[model samples]
Target: MAAKQAERQLVEIFGHAPRDHSSAARTFWQLNACPFIGKECTKFDHTRTICYGTCSVTNAEQEVVICPNRLYENNYEAIRKVGSDVFGDIPFMLFNEYVRIVASGNHQMDCLVALGHNSGKEVKISQLSMDWVIAHIRNQQLVEYVGIEVQSIDITGNYRDAWYAARDMRDSIPASGHGLNWANVHKRLIPQIIRKSLVYSKSLLVKNGLHFIVPEPVYQRFEAIIGANIPLVDRPGKEVIVVHTYDIGPRVEQGRMRRLVLNRELMFDLNEFSKRFISGPNLPPGIALDDKIRSILAVS
Candidate 1:
């Protein structure tokens, strides 16, 4: 089949598993428990560190696949109206850059939005999602990752019910008393998704000796949490991979949106993990200077 041939070609090019082989090849997974209103997202930390939601399976593609919540995240309106088939209408080039980021295995937070499909391609939001997905695919070879723990109580085979566990995890979160930054908290979902991973992501958390910790300014709006990374132990393939969990939020901000987390220690305290993502005041991968931003804008 064409797909098989394409897979072989890609494997030859990158010496990696085919994109469809995530279940068998994935070593790194960045999963997110997002909000239902479509605005906010709660990133479970325990799942990131211990690989709590990790599972077992082979890399063989299944007969019936449930497309992740990604379809829902990209253009909720179009999907709500026309459904998955609508993607067929989107030009392949439109999804090309997105495919690049995912295959590369990392998310550049301060990325610029490029030109529309009409003009020459630029780094658009849609492209960003595709990029992270590709990254998940690329990181599948890391074998260092093992086990996943996020707030989830169910172990049902059906993906439809995964959110039930995720929701329970959300409920376990200690109450907070602060407003949230609309952009910082809400818009951060892409990176969260790009970084978090679990074998079985719950609407809440699933216990596996590891505690599923959540960051602050949290909210949940997603219906079914979709996993981006591939599963290794559950699969019968040999590959090397590792998941990098990052809490890139500022250590602290003085504003009404600041979350008044009742139990500060348990939550993903930003100050504690500040150094993990930021390297010695140097601008990390995706960030650019204000002048650069102005230049990009001018070019746009």
Candidate 2:
């Protein structure tokens, strides 16, 4: 199913549905806060007058994370999972903290460190930046780092009406024209991943390849664009790009909100991805140019 809600309903507001109406929900809404990111919601409408804190939406009867920050739930478990996969079970500290530790002559080796906006520094490659850089530190030196990109689906239309309804503590959301921007999969996201993968593949410090963190639905669309038949690698290696997907699992009974559950981790090399890109999406089998011309003439 499309990530777009059939009725543009609000599945989550401030990380909980309007129907929740708990004290925490009320507090978060009143403060215009985002519990996931531990700050005020950054999304605003065209007027920038109010925070539109919708986090996810119902798609195919399941909640799909629409806001990237929502994936920042569970103390960024998704990112930590990737880090552990790349760097093993060592403790990880944000790069800035690691730097401070080094300054204090207490820097520890054989641990994982992350570099990003929150982690102090984000590395840029070929004028483009990955969301995070996770490095493995051994013997107080850089061993290797993995580049990561985090993405969530874009909404095509405003859900301000639903946001307002939710703000009023209503259980129902007004219908809006919002839809998921699936076209972005092939047009923007795929290209960016390809470019970043190319850059990472050539970098000496990047040995573990690039990684993409996306919602399961977005990852599904990605697989469709790249052709589902493409062979997936079993493990991360130099020049391999992995797509990590997460699902906002069904709300537990009487639970305030749904949980972001790690779903699939699919790995593929740049060579394989490029082949699918060059080939492009499949075309109809029975149509002919002459038949199409005749059909157009008939319609005219």
Candidate 3:
């Protein structure tokens, strides 16, 4: 059953289905690129390629190349590490687990995992919404759910320029910042953070919590924004967990590379607003509630 669901999602994203978890993961890796390591380029015919130039830390003498396979492996490893570092060995279930949990209750369901949306239209896969999800069941009924979003410092636009600048500066670049301010947090990262937050705060998806995994610099920038504009106390529908990370090294033997090291974690639970906050109907609009989900929210 889980295999079928996985295949279905794969077909939706790739136009072809995968047979198993390994195949699905491999397909996902092939379809996605590391936002920080290189720039994605498209040819006139619309063929896309990831371009990684010379070693950022070293001079132009040493050409730098990023292996998509390596980047994908590292990205998954980082996400798993963040989960363990923040939640501490808590057993995490895959999307199949979520499906099973919802099925067991015989309740109506409307949930999406690793799916992307843009202004109600299907967009490319959303890296921000692909973390993990858990459904809490009580008395054989679905009660609440939790979702997580992981973020890393990467350039979103003009990848080649940002990549070169970061290499020249030997530091991470922002999603959007002033001229040559590559290290200062880019403008795009903040919006991504807010959109993920709203998936819970404004949407009806996760009722209990929404976690965000980010580097220390990203966390500080996000916190600063929250402090200046939006106070946590005002929002009650969901909780936000910020996982902070640091850079490990540029140890140069053959070439220079860096790994993000996960460190401390902080959270803000909207316990006070959980019950009072407005929630969308149990299922998303236009999606039919079916018996596979127990039909708990089916309209009479």
Candidate 4:
């Protein structure tokens, strides 16, 4: 009944015949991206049908837009499988561009954008083929763990605290301050301050390391601290925030893939207002209740 209602709502919004696709078994990429994929269960072309589900039900243009849910429930995958002829690169574009396309053309799209700190970061990737990250997370025996860096337990003063922060207020929160400037900060905000500190303690395998795609503010502060120590490592001439392209690049890709799967991936990272705009609790317009009407009719 719930599914039927969702379908009905979709039909009303789209003003067209809804697709009726289903998954045989869940898949990882399909799972996260399921919310966006709807019914075609056949192809990725939004113009022809709704491409929603794990397994393809037909040869006409089997599109599993979302990844398989088999990995686990609630794990979103941003995958789109069109016909073999459509087997080229996926069209990832800006939000405005997608909107423009929608306005100008008679086509439809399931666009995705991923942005966040390390905690909320999403990954993007093709199925099965590891551009190269699978080995690190799974191989415990072949690799030996290496250096562990102790996180600075202290934080600087004038910490950021905006349960409801304006742009002006958030602007000054991330200014440059020296190491663990504890005296300037307060007890109430200490936990949050320390939690935001750069000092981290995570075990990594030799020839392997963790890459955290932190928020821009965190990135800036990190640059402030580590930027000075960068030149000594290898590229002796430059003073910079040194990040190994090989170490962190793959992880970023993974996070991108994850966002694509979740259907929540935005074409651009939202600002404060945009975030609020998208995350509001408001419901879609309600239909006049027909207590006797079955939900299948909604999609039909």
Candidate 5:
């Protein structure tokens, strides 16, 4: 017999599912809190009042991360992983905290400090912004830094009904035409990565290259869009861009979030990634477009 395919619906709300009835789950839902970032959920409804605390969702029986905050699980261990890989095994602190200590002349050098979206002032380069600017402090001076862009696939259609039903302790999640926005992976995300790579590649301070951190499935989709055979380095190197993919591991129990396991780290220079993007498999054929244009003209 064929196994039942999972319906596209809400799988996790504020890190756990609708079916979770534990006191901890209830408390998180009541408080509209996010365990990952250790604060109230950043996503909200249209009015910007109520928290829209959807974390992950079901797609083809697989739980996929939808919220970017969900990526901050395990105390931002993924960021730490990138720091260690690029700047060697060093301790990490929030960038703002580092600044405060530096002002007092008590800051330690040779440590990794991260300037994230919510961590005080943003560092912008020619109007482009990075999700996180990880810097290595040496001798109380800015030595080296890397730009990181973090993304979890966005969703199409509304899951508000399902979220409400889940929040109320419903037995079953309501169906709400929810689906993953896979198109955005190649359309917006990859292009943005390429553009940022170009900007960062020209800088002397950005020694480690720009990193794009995304969920495992999103990276798979990216490879499929652009031919998987494209040449890329397996280890971190002087490449202009690095792609880090992560998979969410199974939870030991309910009422707790899953662990994010680093799956793959692929590196590529600016020329390589941009070449793949321009001539990727997703691009339309020139002859086919010319024919469609002629047909439209003939109809007129």
Candidate 6:
């Protein structure tokens, strides 16, 4: 019963059918078959287009098409789920705790804030690319802003292509790789972490700092590749928390349907994280910089 509820939620969130192992295999095969496998080259242009499409498959009558990119869609849905889970709960953290939820998404970051305000007129500072933001209030006054950025392995072109390629190659004539090579963590996940962290680190309103949510495997890869070697920047007292997730498979319900669970036990404080991981590039001079500097100087 719980599994059924989870599946329903996942379907609502991802707009894809629930896929068991058998169904997934059939879908993979049908989507990867070439449209002109047995046809002569003279009858069809072999070089122009061979496979039906990477994401979907067409029927014999060509009247209907089936899309099998459930895994890809799952990754996207997972990101949004993580964002919703993290930001949606901020308002209920403490009884009578004044909290304002801002800039969340249904399946992606639609509004990475550009100067918004809460009902109480508290300033909400955010970048155009931030994933989500939450503001905390104390004594009827806004005290801190919390930013969140979510990334997935599917963001990398190589990983995405490899995933499809693996499916397509599984039963091809000249069978090659059977699985995704997987993109380098440094190349895919780290860059996003650095980019999002830099944006949050530079924000003047996010006093509580930013959180980056990623899959556990990606986080482990990041730790293995650059453990205890992160570089430092001048953004003192700023924090970039790294949250890793665990895939609890596709059987349970309530945030468990093909969803990744965040490991709250491990957090990477920027003050300490910067001591090892390399810092992102400095922000170029702009009006925002002037304002940030002024705020810092005033606080000091």
lDDT against the true structure, each candidate: 0.24, 0.79, 0.37, 0.23, 0.79, 0.39
The C-alpha stretches of model 2 lying farther than 4 A from their native spots are 1-6, 60-62, 253-255, 281-300
Rank candidates by TM-score, best first: 5, 2, 6, 3, 4, 1
Off by over 4 Å in 6: 1-128, 135-144, 155-184, 228-237, 250-259, 279-300
lDDT (tens digit, per residue) of candidate 4 on 1-300? 343311101110011112211131223224323332332233233465333222111111111111222111122121112111122343433234444665786354433321221112222233211111111111113222111111111322221221112112233222212123223212322222232211211223223222211222222333343232222232211111112210011112211222212211011111221222233223233453443254647642
TM-score of each: 0.16, 0.88, 0.39, 0.19, 0.89, 0.41
Deviation of model 2 at 9, angstroms: 1.8
lDDT assessment of candidate 1: 0.24
The positional error of residue 216 in candidate 3, measured at the CA in angstroms, is 2.5
After superposition of all CA atoms, the RMSD between model 4 and the true structure is: 25.5
Off by over 4 Å in 1: 1-99, 102-140, 146-209, 214-255, 260-300
Native-to-model Cα distance after best TM-score fit, residue 53 in candidate 2, in Å: 0.8
Per-residue lDDT tens digits for candidate 1, residues 1-300, read 345511101110011112322322222222322211132222223355422221111122211101112112233221222211211232222244544765786543222212222113322343331112111111223112112111111121222122233223333322112222333322454234323332212213212111222222122211012212122232111121122121212223221111112222122222212232233232334545655787978963
Question: Which portions of model 4 miss their true places by more than 4 Å?
Answer: 1-205, 226-229, 232-300
For residue 231, give model 3's deviation from the true position in Å: 9.2
Candidate 3 C-alpha lDDT tens digits along 195-296: 556566654645445565554544554544444222243232355534334333333322223443455545554432222122312223344435435567
Q: How well does candidate 2 match the true structure in TM-score terms?
A: 0.88
Model 5 residue runs over 4 Å out of place are 1-5, 290-300
lDDT-best of 5 and 6:
5
- The positional error of residue 45 in candidate 1, measured at the CA in angstroms, is 29
Residue 108 deviation, candidate 2, in Å? 4.8
Mind giving the per-residue lDDT tens digits that candidate 6 earns over 135-234? 4444345555566554434321122333343434433222112222235456655665666666677777764455555544445556765563354343
TM-score for predicted model 3 compared with the true structure: 0.39
Give the per-residue lDDT digits (tens) of candidate 2, residues 117-224. 467767775678778888888888888888889999888776677677777866666765567888888888988889888888887887788889999888888777
